[model samples]
Target: MTTPAIPSTLDVALWLFDQSRRDDVYLPAQKLQRLLWLQQGGYAAMNHGRMLMPAVFVADETGPIEPTVFHLFEDSRPPIPARPIDQVAENHLVRMWRRYSHHSPDYLTKKITQQRCYRDAWRKGAGTVIPFEAIVRDFTDLPTGDQMVRAGDGRALKKWTPSAKPAMRRIR
Candidate 1:
């Protein structure tokens, strides 16, 4: 059997936009970027290293962002044209939204920024590309991360608590 076609970044973004409209809620571009980050990274973590979408995420000041997708809402106004996505991708998107939509944009940004993958990939004032491998490494290295991914809620994966050492920069 042939491999199924993966949806473009635009298609995925539109699907997310549809969800926002349906919920009658406002979803900022930053939150949508984080959701896509989770969708691609978390899905790969659980699916034998397969990506749900072939999008490249960069370490933006706010969090991980797919640049192409971000441009769709560069003005913080979403005018993305809707398009159909594969059923499988649609399902993954739905699950990600449910798992994360409850949190505010700031919360999501803080959560992702604190993670090792985002931390290591980010450079101050530079939007470095967050490689898929880096994301996989972060989750797999976390406590119970694999289990969390299997449960389809990578967001709930255990966080990295700092060890007692020289008090480095304070978090929060």
Candidate 2:
């Protein structure tokens, strides 16, 4: 499937800034742009896996703008109970970290398994917002390994090594 065009950095910046203002969150435009850029590859239309073109326009704070696109992976077991996109967006950064990062807390309690880190924080009255940069930094620093799948008996399947990298070409 063809990848959709990514939004210009400026447009994404503006939209993020507006969303932050409306939601009373203190996110800055630069930070929003960074998040969008990091998430671009992961956004795609459901089932088909076709990437959606991202658009950002100047929008009134109270009026509806465009719906945002998100990627959905098919899972036999849904990790968390279904919820609205806004809530999903708010919680997903931490959820993704828990799934992909090695820096997550070692203890595997029911509370941590059932709720995203920020959601757990809210339940405990901490009322903290984890920064986007912290998530990004941790994700990027994760060690690379052969991607694995689960087998019928619940053990990880054999690893599949990736192909060799292509030679770099010099443009004349």
Residue-level lDDT of model 2, residues 42-116, one tens digit each, is 232111233323433112121111223111111111133333233433343333222333321222222122223
Highest TM-score: which candidate? 1
In model 2, how large is the Cα lDDT of residue 35?
41
Q: Which portions of model 1 show Cα errors greater than 4 Å?
A: 1-5, 76-80, 144-147, 150-172
Model 2 lowest lDDT segment of ten? 69-78
Output the lDDT of residue 65, model 2.
18
User: Would you list the C-alpha lDDT of every candidate in the order shown?
Assistant: 0.71, 0.32
Please report how far candidate 1 places residue 100 from its true position, in Å.
0.7
Scored against the true structure, residue 149 in model 1 reaches a CA lDDT of 61
- Extract clashing residue pairs from model 1: none
TM-score of 2: 0.26
